[model samples]
Target chain A: MKVNYFISDIFYVCLRDLKHYLKQRVRIMATLIQPIIWLVLIGNLMSGLTANPLTLKFLDAPSYLDFMAPGVMVMTTLFTGLFAGVRVVWDRRLEILQKMLSTPLSRTAIPLGKIAAAVVQGNIQVIIVLLTALMLGVTFKTGLAGIMVILIFISLFCSIMASISIALSVNIRNMETFFALMNFITMPLMLTSKAMFPVEAMPGWLKFIAEWNPISYAVIPLRTLVTKGWDWTVIWQSLIILCFFALCFLAGAVFFFKRARA
Target chain B: MKNIIEVKSLSKIFPGKITAVNKISFSVKQGEIFGFLGPNGAGKSTTIMMLTTLHLPSSGTAFVSGYEIKKSPRSVRMQFGYVSQDLAVDDRLTGYENLFLQAKYYHIPNQTARERIKILLNLVELEKRAKDLVETYSGGMRKRLDIACGLIHRPKILFLDEPTLGLDIHTRRQIWQYITDLREKQGITIFLTTHYMDEADSLCDRIAIIDHGVIKVLGTPQELKSRLGGDIITLDIALTHVAKIPRLIKLLKTLTNIKQIKTAKTKITIVTLHAESMMADILKIIQKNSIPLEMVMLKTPSLDDVFLNFTGRSLRDEAGNREQAHKARRMLRRIRS
Candidate 1:
């Protein structure tokens, strides 16, 4: 009975957040616009310069748009997941968190519901990015099947980032500090990963850092599936790493959420 | 009635040895509106936080609804609904949806949750606007909706921290009416905290006057007020030498009607049986002694006087000073963390 209550409470928290997402058209628009800009403008500019052998060697896709599609998909997930902290911060300021903590709801269930919502929303955003890439005349080497696999992989990756964000928000006092800290952290996460450029093209030191970055692990498999074709070894390896990453951060969030003072 | 909450030697000490609640002990009877009245930073909120299981006590034990606060927080949480000083309703959601979500948090079944939400909305006179988003609500309506959200789980005890802190007089009274109605109709015990003396005087069945982490007194409004002896005669003094106020107090104590006299820097309050009858004699004594007197007034004794009688300083001044002190402490903690 207690376990059932915990599950249902998590379900309710997810429902509440999803309802807020649907109600706010502005939030949807804001999250979508930034990634689409990077996908179109920068992707086209890089594709136009592909005649240079250096540029050609660095390009992962048949065209710059194809190469950047997976990067944009990963970027979209990271961007949305990092701001997952914003909602938690607002809830804290508004005392909504206090009310939730005062209830019989399980401690882990609250952050679980929030991270789940972000993952679900992350999947939807990636699909839209893929469609936009399709509109820009990009073709997938692994076709529709690859899109489904990449979507699942990106959702798992987003779950990890969202958990980290929630943990940060709970420990940080306010939004101003949260933004300053996330900016310092997320920019490194995005720039160090092989998201925008080929890892082999990076210098030895940068390449070493990219190899250790979790996003690079997920993005490499996504790019390979979108360009190289269906490879079980690559898919399963990335899936395991992504799942491990998600679990680690999920554990962190639960710890912080339990210790969170309302 | 039986006691529903028993706190023994409760205390909370912050990182730098700042004690918010200091070894305070008290018991709240079941089905009564018990008020924790105090100035800001008097540890009223810290006490509420400890009782609600939001903050753990440093060196004490407490039980809410027969469950130990530390041993069984989940059980303690199941019994009480807490309405914090700041409103907590999601503004994006409709009033009905907010209550519906609250019910789900407590694991109430859907059908029964719906019925309870409807009844609560109606009781709070919010059924008409239940479909509207809470952002559209007036301050009073938002507060009512917050209260309704707390009741969605039908908790045995309800904790409200300064429920009417910023509302106008009209809205404050409306909230008061709803509070009394809830206790009368549902038999839910209420525990509230406030600095407003009149609010405690009129609403609380019993009150604990806390200050600087200690309970100064505890009793019904009439009982506490009656402890003042009689009417209050306030005299504002501007002495020529400024050091003769104590001499004036010495002279006032000799008067037959003056039961008690408390002197501040420039004012003296005399608690007496007959302020009207002794006003002339009191003035004559001050004049005979050639002590400068600025003004004099007489009024009935009140909860504020009771607080003054116990704490020496006025509630308003203590609230102002404590707010600044708390802000400084918070800033320092933020920097350290």
Candidate 2:
């Protein structure tokens, strides 16, 4: 009985969020527009810069757009993951969070539902970007199996980011503070990780910081999967690191939310 | 009647040692409309929060529908519906959608959830606007839907915190009628908290008047009013007879039936079991004293009088002062920063 209620709680919460997301057509357009612009315009512009021999050697890919495709996918996931906190802030401000808490459902179920919806949404967005890349004549070196692995990787990576985002939303008092903190953190995270450029092309100091960034684990494996195809060592390492980040973030969220007054 | 809710010395002290709910205890019978009456900051909402398992108690516990709040919060939560001070419906969702989601959270079977939603929407008279987004609802309509959301799963007890706080007279009456009908039709135990004295007096089977984190008194409205011991008789004296107010109080006090006498500028008020019987004799004394009567009024003691008698201040005055103090504290923090 308890487990059944738990599943239903998660399902209903996720369903509500998804319904809300679909209802706001403007919001859907807004979330999708920025990433498409980055993938089409900026990816092409950056591809021109990587035409030199040193840049070509550093990138190690047949085409710059292909190299940047996975990076753009990872960036899309990161942006989507961070902004997933907006729903938490909205729910809290609007008393939906309180309403859910007053029910018999477990507290963890609420965040899990939100994280699941965000990961699913992020994956869908990533696929859309990938299709857009395909339309622009970008081909993946790997077959369907490798693309499947990358999709799983994006989902796991998004869950971690969504967990952290929701955790911050629970602790922060208002949307202005949440927006400011997310902006300050995401830009630095994206720059320090291998999202925009290859870590091998970076200076030694920058490479060190890039190596430490968790997003690099997600981006590196995705880039490898798209460019070099299936590699057990790469896949396993990325999965383990992503899982570790997800656990830490989820644990942090549950802890802070338990202590949160409302 | 069996007790549907039992609280034992439940308390909630916020951070910085501010006690929002001191060690206060009360219980409610099944199928009864129990009222927690107090001014703002009197801990009514805090008490409801504890009982509904929304906030953990600082020192004690409560049982709702036979489940201990601390030990089995989920079970306690399953046993009660809470209509909080703020509207809890999703503004983005239609009224039916809001209730449907809530029903799902409670794990009610889908078919039953649909039926329950239909029944609840009709009960609250929101069936006509069931398809409209709650953002488009009037204040009263939103409030009605909020209540319907609480009742979606048909819990054993319903907690309504200031259910009619910001409604017009007509809407308030409509909400009250709905509340009474719910109790009559469903036999669901109601636990209501309000600052409205008349609301408590008219609606509750019993009321607990709380103040400063403590319950000052608890009883049926009639019992509470009778505790004040009599009707209140007020005689407003003419300006020329203002000096005779103290003398009038002394004379009124000599009457054995007059239980209490208080004198203010140009007025003398008395509490007596027989205000009508004592009025002539009281007037005779005033006439003999050559003092002109501006106005003489006699009325049965109300819950307001009972509160004033017990708390030494009017409930409305306390509510007003609470707001003022809050503003003053906000200003002081601004100046200090």
Q: Tens-digit lDDT track for model 1 on A92-185?
A: 7787987888898888999999988888888888988888888888888888888888988988889888998999898676789989988998
B1-337, model 1: which lDDT tens digit per residue? 8999999999988777888889999999999999998766678878988999888899999989999999999999989999987778899999999998999888888899999998999988999999999999988898899999888888899999889877889999999999999899999999998767889889999999998899999999877887778888898878664687877778778889678888787888888877788999989988988877788889877888888888886776654543474474356435323
**What tens-digit string does per-residue lDDT give for candidate 2 at A1-262?**
8888788777887888888888889877876776678877988888887778888788888778888888889988998888788998888766678788998777888888888888888988898888888887777767678778889999989988988888888766568989999999899999998888887878999999999998889988888887887778988988988888788887887776677776
Ten-residue stretch with the least lDDT total in model 2 chain A:
A253-262
Candidate 2, after superposition: displacement of residue B251 in Å?
15
Error of 1 at B231 (Å): 3.4
Candidate 2, residues B217-335, lDDT tens digits: the string is: 99999889878787889989899767777767777778877788877877777888877788899889988999888899999988889888877778777545434734643442233
Q: What are the TM-scores, per candidate, against the unseen true structure?
A: 0.88, 0.88
Maximum-TM-score candidate = 2
Which docking class does model 1 fall in? medium
